[model samples]
Target: MPDSHLHEPRDSTLVDLHQDLPDAARLKRLGVVIAVGAVIIAGAGIAWRSHSVGTETVTAHAAAVSDVAVVHPAPAAPTDDLVLPGQVQAWNSAAINARTNGYVRSWLADIGDHVHTGQPLAVLDAPEVDQALAQAEADYQTALANRSLAATTATRWTQLLTQDAVSKQETDEKQGDLAAKTAVANAALANVKRLRAMQGFERVLAPFDGVVTARAAQIGALVVTGNLNAQPLFTVADVHRMRIYVHVPQTYSAMLHPGIVASLDLPEYPGRTFSATLVRTAGAVDVQSGSVLVELQSDNTDRQLKPGAFTQVHFHAAGSVGTMTLPGTAILYGNDGPSIAVVGADGKVTVRLVKIIRDDGNVVRVTGALNTGDAVIDSPPDAIHNGQNVHVTQVLPAVTAAKAGARAK
Candidate 1:
């Protein structure tokens, strides 16, 4: 029975070995398992790749829609005015000084005193001039007496010659002596006249109708005649009108004429504008300043405007070129000179070349191949290029181009 059992186990082990060995079904099953695993891995890889590609596409789309600020160019006027610095001055000013040596006796006028032409401003006590006048008078009288005696002697000599009481030579000598005495008398008379004229200067008089802007005259102040080193007695200014001197740039020189209208603005009188007429201009340009000196006159009958005041002169100029103004931030300075970033209606960025006319800190005046309807990018990015897509984050309010032009006027 034990032998029978061993034989049966052996037979079973053989059957099991055959089953575990490579069989068609088993090999087919193993191949099927490997094929299923490869299919599943390929499907997973395809899914992961699709997901990564989708994420990348979304990220790229997000980057393409960049937010940018956009603004519309301000409407520009056909004509723009120019404002320039000017110097205000008196129409006519003079420094009054002593014409003759004297001491200040009394001043009839002080600073801020308005007087007429030939009006006495001060009285000067000129002792030397008085003495000289007196001496000149005495000399003139003596010369007159001598001239009279010479005339009488000359007449008598001629009469004597006719009577043959004296020689012709002696008569001629007497006539010559009389001529010499007459010339001396004439010189003395001239000296007397000169002294008298100089004495008249002792009364300091106004040269014209004007106001005394300054006075240095004091009681008993000694003044030398024609002394350039001496301080002036008074400063007389014709305040009936005021003169403004402006150095206009050569670019605008052609627009200026003798009658061009200009307005004056002063710091002292804010909001009060004075109308001015162009009086004259230095036709030639100054090499040093590269500008023309223009003179303008304004009526100051009320004496409101004063001399030597800082002023702003506004010149109305007509613009012939199509110019536009934009905010300063819209301008972009690049290697290709000044340029601006413009946005197309389709939201494409396009850089344009521009010519700048003026810069007023926050505003810029530009002229180029641009239209009023074009949108300009404010504070453009450094890497911005032409034909780049942009997404406008905000549309700034329309800036008034007329304000800058108005200020020019």
Candidate 2:
């Protein structure tokens, strides 16, 4: 019933549709392939994301680590010059005080005057002492006259007793009176001698060959005898030699002994050094200061150095075998005390408590649990803690040039 061309076209269209249609078995195979591909892509994506996250975590951890510079502890020199503050004093100094009550009439010697032993420094006018001496002398003379009269009387009485004109008791009494008068005369003479001795103190004399460093007495000044609080009339000091008093630390006290020579540096005399010899020591440590007092003698024949001058004393002290040196920057002061941060082999920080024996400007001498091989952190961070991880960025020399310079100074 249809046209032949139309029927042919419809049959062709049906054939095309049948060819385009896929079988169930083929579709099943395609579905399995697609599923396998999706699983592979998802696994790859997950693995890539995990790798990126791991890389970021590693970078962040590395950034959180602290970088520090480390240094090794250096062995101290076998012998080093230990410099300490000291005071220069006179070899023989004296504070001249009055021995007798008097008024200062005149001063023969004053400050900066060189005097000889037994030389008069001042003259005291003691009217009371003079009056007393005159009285004592008059008393002595009266006693002598009494003794003479008594002797004459006793001789006459003895002669009369021989003649039997006076009784024996009367003669004995006369002899006793003569003896008593003689005793009184002796006592008066003793009093006169004591007064004369006291009068000799009117002249203030020098005790030794020295220079008058101070003069407190003035003309018309009243001086009291045996006054503990009275100012000295004069201060004399022997400057031919000087004595240096240095308070050496107890740790270095053992190095100080008699005959050891030291050098002194005074601020007044810059760039000049004076030689001194150790003469004595306190032989005991001062508990309050933890130091030992040492005496050193130096020649001042030139009289350039003065008493009571501050100086720097350089003592050649032998270092202990266990002593160690480190840069001051390595020291860490905390609430506990002075300490040092040390880096271990495992890149961990360990704080060691230390005691500072000496602190130079840039260097320090210390003793503690640290060893020569320890790696100490220089300029440690304030927040640095014990047992913390750190990255050592650099290793510094144990003794830097700056530290050496400081030690030399």
By TM-score, the best candidate is: 2
The TM-score values for the models, in the order shown, are 0.65, 0.66
Write candidate 1's Cα lDDT for 273-345 as tens digits.
9999888998999999999999999999778899888999997756546777788888899899789988887
Find the 10 residues in a row with the least total lDDT in model 2.
9-18
Residue 271 accuracy (lDDT) in model 2:
97
Candidate 2 C-alpha lDDT tens digits along 1-409: 8778655545433334334456886677668989999999999999999999999999988976789999898877777787899999998999999888999999999899999999999999999989999999999999999999999999999999999999999999999999999999999999999988889999999999999999998999999988888999999999999999999888677667888778999998899999998899999999999999999999998998899999999987666677788888999898998999999999989988998766665788888998888999999998888888899989998874346776777
Indicate the TM-score of model 2: 0.66
Model 2 global lDDT (CA atoms, 0 to 1): 0.89
Candidate 1 collision pairs: none
Task: After the best TM-score superposition of candidate 1, give how far the Cα of residue 134 lies from its true spot, in angstroms.
Answer: 1.3
Tell me the number of clashing residue pairs for each predicted model.
Answer: 0, 0
